[model samples]
Target: MESTDLMKKINSFALRSFRDNADRDYIHARMAYRAQLYPQCFWSSLHALEKYAKCILILTRTERVRIKKNNFDDVGHEVLKSLKMLESSLNIILSQQTIDFLKRLENGARFRYLEVSWHSESAELTILDRAVWELRRYCNSGLYSYENSPEVKLLDNVKELLQDIENVTVENTHIAGGRLEAILKQPKSPARKELVWKNLYFSNSKRKTVWLESNFMAENSSLFLYPEIIDELTKYTRIPKEIVNAYKNG
Candidate 1:
C-alpha cells in the first residue's frame, strides 16, 4: 500500500480502537462511581477523556512532531495537553470549566493515591460525569463526521466487500473439501480410494499450509455496553428527566 493509504488505515484503526476503548473506560468509571470507589472512578474518568482527546488528535492527523513539541508524546495521561493541542491545532474552543476540571484531574498523585475525596456527593459525581459526557460527545461528533466523509465511506464499503469475498471463499472451500472427503469414504471403490488417498496424502505432505486465525477485536464486548448507573444516577443527581430517560433507553 502507498504511504497515504497506510496512514489512512493507521488513523482509521486508531480512531476506532480509541473510541471504543474510551467508551469502555467511561463505563468502568461509572461502575466505580456507583460502587463508591472514588479514586478508581476519578482515574478511570480521566483516562476515558484522555482517550477521547487522543482520538480527536489522531483523526485530525496531528503530526507526531507537533505532539512531541507540545510534550504530549511523553505523557499519555496528560488530558490537558491533548486538550490544549486540540484547541490550538484545530481552532476549537473548549469551555473554561472543562479545562479547569481537566487541569485539576491532571494531578496524577491525587487520583492515583486517593489523596482527595473529589467525588463524594451525588452533585460532585454529576459534575464529573457531565465533563466526561461533554468530551465524549465532542469526540464522537468529530469521529462521526470523518466516518461519514465520502472517502471514508468508500473505503469502508470496499473493506466490507473484501470481507464478504473472504468469508465466501472459506465457506466454499470447506464445502468442497467435505464433498471430496465423503466421496473418498464410499465403500464401492475401496482399492481405488486407497490409491487416490495415498496420492493425496503424498501431495499434501509435500506442501504445508498453516491456517492462522484472525484476531480482530470483537466489536460488541460487554464492557462497552451501557452500565446500570445510567438509571441510578438519575435518582441521585438532578439530571434532566428527558436526558435521563434517553440515556436509560439508549
Candidate 2:
C-alpha cells in the first residue's frame, strides 16, 4: 500500500481507539457521579472532554498540522482552548453555557490533588452532558468511514444516559447525600439499567487492552519520538540542524 493509504489506516485505527478511550473515561465519570464521587467525576469528565476535543482535531486536520501553537500542545488540558482553536477551522461553535462549564471544569481539574476546596453547582453534570452530547454528535457524523471498526456500545448507550439525566438533578460536593442517595435508589430507566450492565462489560479487559495497545504504539513508535521536530518543521520549511542534532544526541 502507498504511504498515504497506510497513514489513513493508521489514523483511522488510532481515531477509533481514541474514541473508545474517551468513552471509557466518560463511562467512569458517569459512574462516579452516580456514586456521588464528585471529585473523581470531575477529573474523568475533564479527561473525556479533552480527548473528545483532540479527536475532533484529528478528524479534521492532518496529523502533522493539527494545531500550530506550542507544538500542538497549547490546548493541553484546556477544553475551552481546544474548542476555541477548532472554532474557525471546523466552523463549530459551542454555546456560551457549555463554554462556561468547560472553564469551570478546567478549574475543577485542579481539585484533583485536594490542594484547595472548590464548590460546584449541582447542575454541572447536566452541562457536561450537553458538551459530550454535542461533541459525540459531530464525531458520529461520518467524517470518515467506520464500517470496519468494531462497534463501541458506549457510544450508543451514552446518548440515552445523557437523555435520562437531562432532567434528573445531579448533585455536587457542596450539596451531597439525602436527595442524591434517593436519586440513585430510584427505579432505573431502561437506559440506566443497560448502562449499569454495559458499564461493567466496557470496563473490562477490552477497554484496557485498547488503551494499552494505543499507548504502547505511542511510546514505542518513532513517529511520536520527537514532537519538537514536528514543531520546528511546522514553523519552518527546514528543521535547523542543531535541533535535529540535539535530539539525535539527547
Candidate 3:
C-alpha cells in the first residue's frame, strides 16, 4: 500500500515488459528480413531500434521534453528524436550515416505501406543491414551496462529472497498436508509487499503505457520514468552521474 512498495512492483513489471518487447521486436525484424519482406523488415527493424533506445533512456533516467505543442505523434515515431535523446541524455554519439538511415526509416509511411518508389532490393537490404547492425550494437551495449549495474544486483537479490520465501512456504504447505488455505493466509513479508507494490505502481505509470503501446506510428510527446525509480536507476547508470543527479534534483 505504501508508495515505495507500489514503485517496486511497477519497476519489476516495467523492466520485464521492456526486456520482452525489445527481444520480440528485434526477432520480428529478423524474421521479416529472412522472409524477403523488405518493407516489413525495414519498419520492424526501426521499431526494434526505437524500443531499444527507449529502454536505454529509461535505464539512464532520461527525461523527455515536448518541443512542439500538440505534437505527440511527431515525438513518438521519430527515430531522430530517439537518437537525439540518447545523445543529449547519455552522450551516446551516433554517426551521421546511421542517423541518415534511421531518418529514412523513421516512419513506416514511406516504406511499410509502399508509398514511395521501389528501390533496388540489394541497395535497400544493405541499408537495412547496416541500420540493424548499428542499432543492435547500441542495444547490446545498453543492456551490458544494465546487467553490470548495481541496481540490477539489488533487484536480483530481492528476487532471490522472494524465491527463497516462496520455497519455504511451499515446503510448509506440504508439511501441513497441502492445506492450501493456510499457505495462502501466511503473512506477506515486507520485501514481498514492496515488490508487489512496485509492480502495481509502475504498471499504472505512463512509462509502461508509452513503451507498450502497439501504435508505433503514433507520436508520443513525452517519455519519462517514475522519479523514485529514476533516482535509484541513476546510481548505477552509464550516464554521467552529475547529469543524472541534476535531472533527479532538478
Name the top TM-score candidate: 2
- The TM-score of predicted model 2 comes to 0.53
Task: Residues 1-250, candidate 2: write the lDDT tens digits.
Answer: 2255654665565456655567667767877666667777778888888887877666545334545643555566777776666655454545677777788789756434432345545555555666765564444324433343321122443344333423322311111222222233555533344233323122111231111111111012231354455554546555445445555565
**Whole-model lDDT values for every prediction:** 0.50, 0.52, 0.43
How many clashes (backbone N, Cα, C below 3 Å) per candidate?
0, 0, 15
Could you report the Cα RMSD, in angstroms, for every candidate shown? 20.6, 16.3, 20.8
Q: By summed lDDT, which 10 consecutive residues of candidate 2 come out lowest?
A: 209-218
| Model 1: residues with Cα > 4 Å off, grouped in runs | 1-8, 70-73, 108-111, 114-122, 140-250
How many Å off is the CA of 148 in candidate 3? Answer: 17
Ranking by lDDT: 2, 1, 3
lDDT of 3 by residue, 12-104 (tens): 544445534644554565455545565676667677667656655454444444323323333464566765655533445445666777866
User: Which parts of model 3 are misplaced by more than 4 Å?
Assistant: 1-15, 65-74, 107-112, 120-130, 136-250
lDDT of 1 by residue, 38-155 (tens): 6676688788788878876666656678768866664478777776776564443446666777776687433242222243433334445446544543343222234433222222
Worst 10 residues of 3 by lDDT: 171-180
Error of 1 at 93 (Å): 3.2
TM-score of 1: 0.49
